[model samples]
Each structure stands twice: as C-alpha cells, then as structure tokens.
Target: MSVITQPTDLLRQQDPQMADVLAGERQRQGSTLQLIAAENFTSGAVLAALGSALANKYAEGYPGARHHGGCEYADLAERMAVERATALFGAEHANVQPHSGSSAVLAAYAALLRPGDTVLAMGLPFGGHLTHGSPANFSGRWFDFVGYGVDAATGLIDYRQVQELAHAHRPKAIVCGSISYPRHPEYSAFREIADEVGAYLIADAAHPIGLVAGGAAPSPVPYADIVCATTHKVLRGPRGGMILCGSEFAERVDRAVFPFTQGGAQMHTIAAKAVAFGEAATPAFATYAHRVVANARTLAEALEERGFAITTGGTDTHLITADPAPLGLDGPTARGMLAAAGIVLDTCALPYGDGRGIRLGTAAVTTQGMGEAQMAEIAGLFAGALRGDAAKTRTDVAELTREFPPYGA
Candidate 1:
C-alpha cells in the first residue's frame, strides 16, 4: 500500500486548507524526533475514527440507558469500547468516559473517598502526578494527602517508608504508581499495606498500561481496587482516559463519573478509543511495547557512556532520567537546545530536590520506526548538543528524522 493513501489525497483535492494543516504536521514529524516521555503518536486509523461522522451525534448515557433518543448506533460503539477495554485489562468493568488520565483519577477518588478523608500518596516531586496529592489540585483540597518519597541516595521508593506512612496516616486510600519512577512498585506489597491500614489501593498505571497489557510488565488489576490510566501513552491511542475496577465497585465508579463529574461523553473520542483498543489487542502491540523498553535501556546506556548519571542507575520501562550536570547543562537548558534541534523532550526534577535531569522516552521515536541504531544516533545528537555542539546536533537530528519519518510516512 502507498504511504499517501486516500485520506491524504482526498484532503489535497477537496480541502486544500485542511490539507495544509496535515502537510505541515507531516513536515514537522519528518524533521524532528520526539523523545517526550509521556507522548506518543496515534495511528492514522485512530485519527480517522476521531474525526468521523460519530462526532455529529450526542449520546448522554451508557448503552440501554440514556437521557436522550437516537442513540442505538452510539450505544453499540460504546458497548464495544467498554467490552474491549475490560478484556484487554482483565477487569470486571471499565469506564471509557473520563476525559483524561487526571479526570479518571478524580472519578476514582470521588467514588472511593469522601472529602476530608486522610490519604497516602507518593510525593509529586518524587514521580507522582499532580492529581495524586498536589496542594493546588482537588485531590489535596478534598483530602489530607500525606506523601512518601524515594530514598534520596538510591532514587527509589522506600517500601518500608510507605508502609510506615500508611500506618501513621490511616488513609482512606493509598495511591500507588508514578509518572517518572523507573523501577516497578510492588503492587501486592501496596495492597498488603492498604489492607493492614484498612485503605483502598488505587493503582494509577497511566504510564505503564501498555507494558502491563503486553505482559512485559506486571498487572495491578488483580490487586488494585481501582485502576486509572490514559489511553494515549504507551497504549498508542487517542487522548482519552479509562477507569477499570472489579464488580464490587462498579456501581459507585459509574455514578461518580456520571452524576458527580462530567456531562455528555465525547462519542467521537470514544470511537477513536475503541479503534485504539482494537489495535492494542494485537500481537504487534506486544512487540512495540517490548521495543519501547529496550530502546529506553539502550538510550540510557548510551547517555551513561557519555558520563550522564541515570536515575535509579537505569530504567526498567519506557522512560529514563539523566542528570545534565556532567554535560554542562541543566534541565531547562537541555530542553530548550533539544527543541531547537527538533528533538522534543521534557525537563523534570528528580525524586529529591531540584535535581537537574532531562527525562527521555522511546515511544515517540519507536512510533517513528527508529530502533536501537537510530536511538544511538539521536542520543549522540543530544550528547553533542548538550556539550556545546548545537550546530552539529541540529543538522544531524534533521537528517536522521527526515530518513525515518514517524508513522512510516
């Protein structure tokens, strides 16, 4: 099949203005390699579904239960999505309604926790998301969130410390998962701690859902009372979120999402999510997930070879954190220089203080079809750019990205 298929052709002929938008996007992707740890490119099929005719309709409730009429087709689509998601994650019920990962977290919290209840969560600066317990977020406003952090010296979560916090706080829920940590959390350990303290275990697997689904990483479905995740990250889906839980909590979860938060669901995005779920169920997604981890490790090794200090000594998943101090750069500077060179990535603080580190991942590059060999090339560009060779880095990134355009375009 040709790379420029019917969609590209139809847009070029019927809608030149919209065609220009896509062309510009294609040009950008062809000239830059993205390394942002939380970002990934969805398939063209997913995009097609997102922009499909389903967007024209309004569906106010779940299948066989709606506040409005003319929803038979919408009901079918929603049911397919719900069933596929539950099967994929091995959960008893799934809600594909939350707008984003954070929204899903809010729904779970609202369902399982009451305001002013004490909660235990990982510290935000230590790999936890803002929704977990950040003061400015609703999670913090509604609950007293006591946090645990990674050991300062080891850069890893201290399980004993978490257990101690749970015992001390007597939390209503113990949130487990991270946006930046490398090593896997002991979910069963967390469950044990939660049980001992009479707290519910909520696993925020937004970063590792794809890995878990592929069996390359462990699943928390069996132990966690509720699981929340973004469908876009490693799942390679449209930008949406999901809430998965066992039958025991299904009613409360649904009620929280419908009556407590949000109005009509975005049926178009749901359709796109359904397509993404189908794509993720394939054996190819397993291969893709495994390669993402492999690529991260390779990139980490390459950076360490050049004297950068990797967080936790290495990565066991799709992301890696490296101190830019050795390269004469800080997180902000490294991010700016890399973006100018068309290599997009984020600058993040380490588990402790304002530790200088640039967080990188393999999903975007792997989506662009670059394996370990190309990762080595991109890492070299980063090393050069950070070490006072910006000109060479820009030139090299443009060349390498042009050769391996994302989506295989």
Candidate 2:
C-alpha cells in the first residue's frame, strides 16, 4: 500500500500545500463511507500504471500508427489496453482512448448517426446519463432524441412501450443503460426491438462492465452493435472510457473516437485499464463481483424494513435506489443528513414521482472486504443518520470505517 502514500510523501517535500489536500482526501475516504454507485477503489498495481512513464506521452492515433514521434511506449500501452479489453469483454475491437464515459457515448453517436438522426434512450428522469440527450450536451443539440421510461408502478423498463415508440419514430439507434436503475438491462429484448425497427443497438454498460468482465453479469457484447463503458466504477481502474464493437463497425468506431471526437490518447489511464482488465479476469475478482450484488440486495431489504421504499423491490446489481419519504424526509434532506453523519452517496430521480431518491452501491465496501452482514449495518447507519442525532451517527460511521480501511486494515 506504499502506492497510496509514496506520491504524497514526495509532494510533501516540494509542495506541502497540495500534499495537505491529498492527505485530507485520503483521511476523508478512510474515515467516511463511499456509497456512490459510480465509484470504487482501484488496485495499487493500477495506480502505479497511472503514474508510470506513459503519462508523459502524446500518442495521437491507434497502435502501429501515430501522429507524433517517440510514441513507442505509448503505442505499447494502448495495444495492451485494446487487447485486454477485447479479450475481457469478448469484443472484436476496443478503443480505449476516450477521456470519459460521456466521451465514449459521443463517439458511438459519431460512428453511427448523422445530425438530425433520431435516437431513442432512457429518459434522464429515470436514471439515464446526460449523454443520452440532455439539452445541455452535444447529443441533444445535434440529434433528434426521443426518450423512453420505466413503468411507474414496477420501476422497470416498459419494453412494449419502447417497441411502440421505436416503430413510431424509427430512430437510427437505441441506447440501453442507466445511472441508477439497480437491475440488469434486458439486452436481448433491446436487440430485438432495435432489429424490428432497423436501428443500431448501443449498450452503455459503464456501471456493469466490471461485473461483465468478472462473469457476474450478462454480456452486452453479444447483443449490441456498439458497447460503451468507463474504465472506473466497479471496474476499478483509472478514470477513462472505451468503446467495443464487432469488426464490422470497428474502423468507423476507431475513426470516430480519434480525429472525429477526441485528441491524443490518455496513455497512462489506458495502461491502468490494461492492469484492471487483467485483474478482473482472475478468480478473486469474480468472487468480489458476485459479493457486490449480494451486499446490495441485503442492504436494499434492510433499508425497506427501516421505512425506505426500495426501488424495483431490490437489486440484481451493485446499485440500489430508494425513497426516504417514508421516513418523513425528501432525497435532498436525507442526503444532507447522511452527509452530516459521514455516509457519502448521491440523489437520483424517482420513477414514480417528481421527487428525487437516494442512490447507493456496494462496490467500494465490498472492496474493503465487507459482506452481507456489514451491508445490514450500513442500512442501520442510514436510518440513524436520517432520524437520530448527527454527531452520534457520525461517530458510529467513523467507528465502522476504522474497522475496514480502504487501503488496508
């Protein structure tokens, strides 16, 4: 775990002020909880790769070809990242150079659609990412977007309604993924709908790509024409994005990610992604992935017992979304209370109402070696944080986190 401290140690000599900030962040992570659905701790090996020599490179193209000289090491890193990603996800090709998940989605759009081409995606109110056509992003400005949503009663995708919309609008592409849905997407159903309407199926598997790599979740590679994901989240790599597809769209995808959308590759993050893909292929990561789901399910049930309305009844993935209104609190008020009590998480749009709900995940806690029992403990903490004295709840959270340090015990 020297990987966690060595950089800070060196920075403390030349730049004590910035060193103090890093130290504060480290202490905050160690002393509090991380329930955010889109966050996780990267392994030390991955961190080392991120800080390696490749960070200085400026490679601007795919392997065996570049727009800059002295890209020998940079090309090597990208090739390894591409190969490992293709193997890990069972795709024919991978572009690991997009700076973030949103960028990957942009490249996917660039590869397949023209300006004004209609696109169908989950509505932002029901857990969709902003790239799915938020008015604030490029996708909304350039393309005509139609939104689909979950059933208000069941809190799940309404496939029949999606089919009706797809046929009516005949969009050029359909996107399947969400930021806080808490369940596995039916990729086969999406593929069927897309095929019936002559639309390309795009799977934004950012949140579940790690589970897919570990064999804990179904693969979207076999079903979607294009798959977009992040190298972080449950994948536990440095923050970056990648695109996967069959060879048929491989060239178009690569070109879109390079000159059309992004600049030089982030060689360091790509190297770190290679390390994570290697780790995820191991037996240990598979166990960890399944345990993430187990902890999420247990936490969801426990929260329901304590007066939160669990979305979709429970979770089949690491994510869980719940309403705190049953406890006489709204999402923002509940979040402020939890933050005061040192339990970190995010607020999400609810399926049934105009109000927001709390969203959480078990990846970080599972990485800290917690299990189902600890998940129940966390739910108890949530209740106390929302309904009891803030100082007492904060103390209990600190005590619990001390028992399981993120880097080590």
Candidate 3:
C-alpha cells in the first residue's frame, strides 16, 4: 500500500495557492457555527479515507463482480458500504454508488419510471428538492411532474391536497421528503396515496436519514418502495448518494446507477461512506440525533420569543424555516447578516409567494457538542444580528464556537 501524506503537506508542495484556500476554509469551519441543514463536518478518519489512494482505482461494478482488474480493495470498501447502509436503513438491498443525491434520484427514476411517466411531488418552493421534479431539472423535463404544496394557513403539508392531486394525476410515482420541511413527513400517508393511485412511493430521505437511523424520526424504509439519500447531511458522511430498496428492485436500481447514471464509482468516497455508516450505527449517534432535534426546538422557541415566526410553528427534526419578514429583513439580507456574524445558514423562499425565509439546522451545532443552552445563545445572537448588534453578536458567536470546536478540535 502507498503511504498517504497530509493534505496540507501535499497541497503545499504541489500548489501553495490551493493550500491557502484549504487552510482558510478549515479555519472558517473551525471558527463558525455551521447551521446549514445540508452541511456537516465529516470526521478526520473519513477525511483520511477520502484523500486515500483508493481514489486512483476505477471500480466499474458491484463487489465479487467487477469489469476491471485490481479491485480487491475497492470491492471490500463498496461491499462494506452496501452492507452497512442496508443494515442501517433496514432495507433488503442497498446500492452505494451514484455520485450525488441528484444522481441517486435520477437512477431511482430510471429504474422505476419510463419517459413521460407522471410523478407527483412536493413543489420546489414548498421545500422539495430540485430532483423532486423542479421544472428546470431533468426529472421535470423527462417526466410529467405534478406538484403539491403546504396548507396556506398552517404552512404544513396538505395531505388531503396530496391525495386529491394523486387521484387526479394518477402518477406513476409519488416522491416524498423535502429539503426545508421542519416536520416529519407523513410517509405512511404518502404510501397510502401512492397505493390509491397505483403509484410507486419514492422516499427522498436525503435530509433526515441520520434521524431515521438514530430513531429520532420514523423510518421510510418500511413504507416506501424505494428510498434515496445523500450520505452527507445529518448522516455526517462523505458527499455521495445511495439507494435502498427491496430485493425485487435491487438489480434494477443497481443497473440504473451503473450503466445508466455513472461509470466507475469513487472508491475513496465509498470507503469514507463505510466509515461514516459505522460511526452512525454506534449508540452515541443515537444521542446525537435526538439532541439535534432538541436543540432545533430550543432554537426555534428562542427565535419565536424574539418575534420571529417559525414556519409550521416549530420543528420536529433538525431543521427550522423561519419567516424573516417580521424582522424587517429579506432572506438574502438575513443570510448575509448572520453570515457576517460567523453564523452560517441558508435563505429559502417561503412555501407561498416570493417572500424569503431563513432555514436553520441543528445537526452541525449538535455535532460540535452544543446543547440546549448553546442553542439559546445562538438564537440570541441571531436576534442580535438582526437587531443591529452584529459586532457584539460576532464576538459572542466566536466565544461560543471556541467552546465547541468543529471536528472536536
């Protein structure tokens, strides 16, 4: 085996400019509160695996069945990822390839739906992802996509509307899950709707797979015909996607991922994913998952106390989407203001209209060992930033971040 050098050393030797960029990013992450719902600080062990020599290989097929030579180690890594994922999600089969969350969704679509097939999914502006049939994405261009939105008054998923749309569209597939939804998706209800319309249910658990595996949220594996997720997010894994399904659809999903979506899998990333899966299966991860939800609730309450309107009232998961209009700030302005204070988050459009909203998550902060008290402090800093005390809030944020260093220092 070839020896692997530290990223800083190797990059410094090859390109000093790129090395500076990496160092700057590392410092930024180490000093900031990462509240982005889709982001996390992967472990150092995962980073090592990601930067390993396994990246040099080109593994084109599943374990024990590869098209290329010299895949012994690659096969081991991929098999470990597949097994751990299957075990983690309690699925009959798991495909550990597919380069991204988008790729995974594409593969799932290809495996189940034909061209021009109708798919009923949540509207993009209503918290659904682009791959969930946004008009600009391939999912929308290739297939007929009907969208459902939240109830206008409550800002919650209108299941009655979903069923009505399902019955009207008679879609071939019903996609569930969202990028910004604060409450747990009614997966069983979606399954029922899909059954009523003779449609396959695709659960895009990309944002909450860790919560599912940690038992903080309900698992969709038992209800949906196919489930897709990105290994990052709350899972705290490398950036990659996975597909989980029953035995009947295993082969179809795998083929769609391989010949249909991508070529050789990234062995290094797969190896890192296996590491993350192992970490997630531990008992400690369960506590972390629950704490993430707890912290989110605390933060939402804090924000609400300061006069911010949390969409859906509050959060049952790691994410919270707050209407920042009451704060006299638009989504972009709120994001910029908070970012300047070293509090990182994203801006999203509200479920209805063109108004902007602020989306916050507790996964990364909880991972950094922050608890409810810290969440309250963070929420205070958020209010301070919006209330024109950004400098003081920045200092407070720095102090808090110092107490809970990213990557555990």
Candidate 4:
C-alpha cells in the first residue's frame, strides 16, 4: 500500500468500524456529483495539514499570547494563517480562528453592535443566511433586525428599498450577503447606504470570498467595515471561518473572535487554511476560479434551455439557483429525483416565485476538470432525472464521474 491508503489501513487495524464508514464516505463522494453551492474538494496538501499532529495540541488565545505552554509551533501556524489570509484578500488584518461561517458572523456582530441594536439585512425568506436575522438564531433574538427583499420582478437586490429601510430604521449596521442570490452584491451601493444612515457595513461574504481571492468577483474588503467569510466554498480551502478588516477594527474583531465568542483555536484547521490561502494565491488558482464562473454560466444557460427558471436570469459566480417548476417539480422533489440519479445539490428559496428552487455550483465539477461540454451533458442528465428515469440517469452519471474522478486512480 502507498502513503495515500496507509492511513485507512492503520485505522482499519485499530478501529475497523470507523474505518469502514470513512471508506464508504470516500466512495460515495467519488461516485456522486457534488453540486452543493457551499462545497468543494480541498487539495491533498490542505488535507495533509488537517491531519497533522497539531490536531492534538491545545492552544488558547492568539499567537505569542497563548495562555498555555508549549505553543511555539501553534503560534507559528496561526501567524502563517493570518498572514496568508490578509495577503490573499488584500485586507489590513485577518482572523482565521472562527470555527465556521456563522461563528465569523457572530464575531462581526459582537465587535460592531450591542444587543438590541437595530440591524438591516436581507430577509430570511429572500435568501439570507440564518445569522442574518432568522428568529431562531442568536442574531435575531439579541438584535432588532429589519429585513430587506429582492425586486419581485427581477429577483435582484432591491437597493432602493434597502436605502429607504436604512434611512427609516437608522440601523447600527447593515449586512449585505445571501445564501441563494446568484449575483454579486454592489458593495459601493451598500457602502453609500450605510454611510447615509451612519451605520457600519458588515459584509457576510461567506459565498463570494473564494471568487474574490481568485479575482473572479468584486471584493468587499474595501467598502465594508468588517468582512466575514468561510475558507471553503469556492476558495477550495478547509472548512473554517475567517474575518478581515481594516487596521482600525482589527483588534476589536480579533478580541470578539477569541474571548467573546470562541475559545481555543483549532491549530490543525488553521494550518490547513494557511495552506489553502497559499494555494489560492497562485496563477493556477486564478485560472481555476475564472473557469468556475464560466462553467456556472454554461450550466445555468443549459438548464434554462431545459425549461428551468434561472434566477436573476443567470449567475455571475459559481452558484446558480433555479426554479424547476416548469418541469412540474418543486425544489425538494427535484432534489430527490436528482439524488436518485446520483446527483447532489441543495434546495433554496425563490425570491420571485411561489415555491423553493434548487441551488448548485460549478466549483467541485470544475475542480474535477469538467468543462462546458460536460456541463451541457449534466443539464441533460438533470432533465432525464426529473422525468423519473433514475436507472439510466444514474448509470450515465456514474460513467461521467468515472471519466473525471475527483482524485486520480
């Protein structure tokens, strides 16, 4: 056996049960299409970092100020992550400690607003994340959140309404980001509105941060007071959260992430994030990022041609949210049919329609070396799957996946 398979072999020797489950998951991932909008496969180097010995270490607080002893290596890992993150996103300061995207958003709110303060964010039903203002979330329970919606006709952000809300509510902060909206948010317009209302601009860039790193999308670092993002998604990093800000807000953001919201930093994940940040800065990553967008546009167009209602008419990034109502399938039904055909994706709210829609992205498929031709074929597969042709569609999907295995044979 080679180094790649040695770990599984060792695990099987000691813990056969977990080893089997892990092996099954690996098989499932390679066999099925990973079209989830928030998912991507990280490089082997990043995975190696995650499995490093740092996972056993317990390092609390920031680098050089750790509350525990024997943290010299931990400090080095965290410093590398912070430096790489700042350079990749062109931010003055970066915090790579938040456990997930929601944690990052929590830190941003903690640093900027007090409990019960007014905040303006996209409404939950209009594709906003739970951290934005879902009543069940800490954000909505703690703060007074005013929700914004998209233009009913265009399925686009209603900037005019946002401005009016900002002026009327006098919110302490304004959040500009979403889970299903496919277009880039106009950061400048958001800045103008926040400035007009004397509110801080907090950009929850969990989705587009990867494209920003690859130069495929506009960055919010310049316009927002604080930016919260996930390290994965289109960024192709490990699962982790990151916060970027100007030097003025750096300390507050860091403190909020450290003592206020979270405790010890996961040194292994931080190391993995550093490796991912380094990878994302390369020329190849930029090409990959742009290709992700190209593939998404192609897929969106192909799906539209197949009778699905493409949201916002199309996509500007890796994500595409489309209503499958034309095919007599709602989002959940479409998702079930796709799963039967070995295709995987998520269901999301349709801003301009009556029911839910399916949300997917090209990041993983593009990473697997798929191109425009493959995207068109996938659309055909989607149509066939929704028509209840599960066996044939699953067989074709397996054949296509075999040609472009996520990891080489």
Task: Give each model's whole-structure lDDT.
Answer: 0.86, 0.91, 0.90, 0.94
**Model with the higher TM-score, candidate 1 or 4:** 4
What are the runs in model 4 whose C-alpha is more than 4 Å off? 1-7
Backbone clashes in each candidate structure, one number apiece? 0, 0, 0, 0
Worst 10 residues of 1 by lDDT: 1-10
Q: What tens digits encode model 4's per-residue C-alpha lDDT throughout 34-122?
A: 99999998888888999999999999899989989999999999999999999889999999999999999999999999999999999
**Could you tell me how far off, in angstroms, the CA of residue 317 lies in candidate 2 after the best superposition?**
0.4
> Candidate 4 has which clashing residue pairs, if any?
none
List model 2 lDDT by residue over 1-409, tens digit each.
Answer: 3336634567899999888888888899889999998999999899899889888988898888899999888888788888999988889999999999999999999999999999999999988889999999998899998999999889999999999999999999999999988889999999999999999999999999988988888999999999999989898888999999999999999999989998998888899999998898889999899999889999999999999999999999999999988899989989999999999999999986769999999999999888989988998998888876789989998998899889885
Model 1 per-residue lDDT tens digits across residues 1-409: 0153434677789999988887787677668777888889888888888888889888777889988899898888899999999999899999999999999999999999989998898988887788888889998788899999989899988989999999888999999998888778889999999999999999999998988877768999999999999999888888989999999999999998986888888888998999889888899888989999989989999889987889999888998988887777778888888787777888777776566578888888887778999878777887777766777788888888777776564
lDDT per residue (tens digit) for residues 129-196 in model 3? 99978779998899998999999988999999999999998999999989999999989899889989
| RMSD (CA, angstroms), candidate 1 | 2.1
Q: Cα miss at 52, model 2 (Å)?
A: 1.1
Top model number, lDDT: 4
Candidate with the larger lDDT of 2 and 4: 4
Task: Supply the TM-score for candidate 3.
Answer: 0.97
Off by over 4 Å in 3: 1-7
The estimated TM-scores of all candidates read 0.95, 0.98, 0.97, 0.98
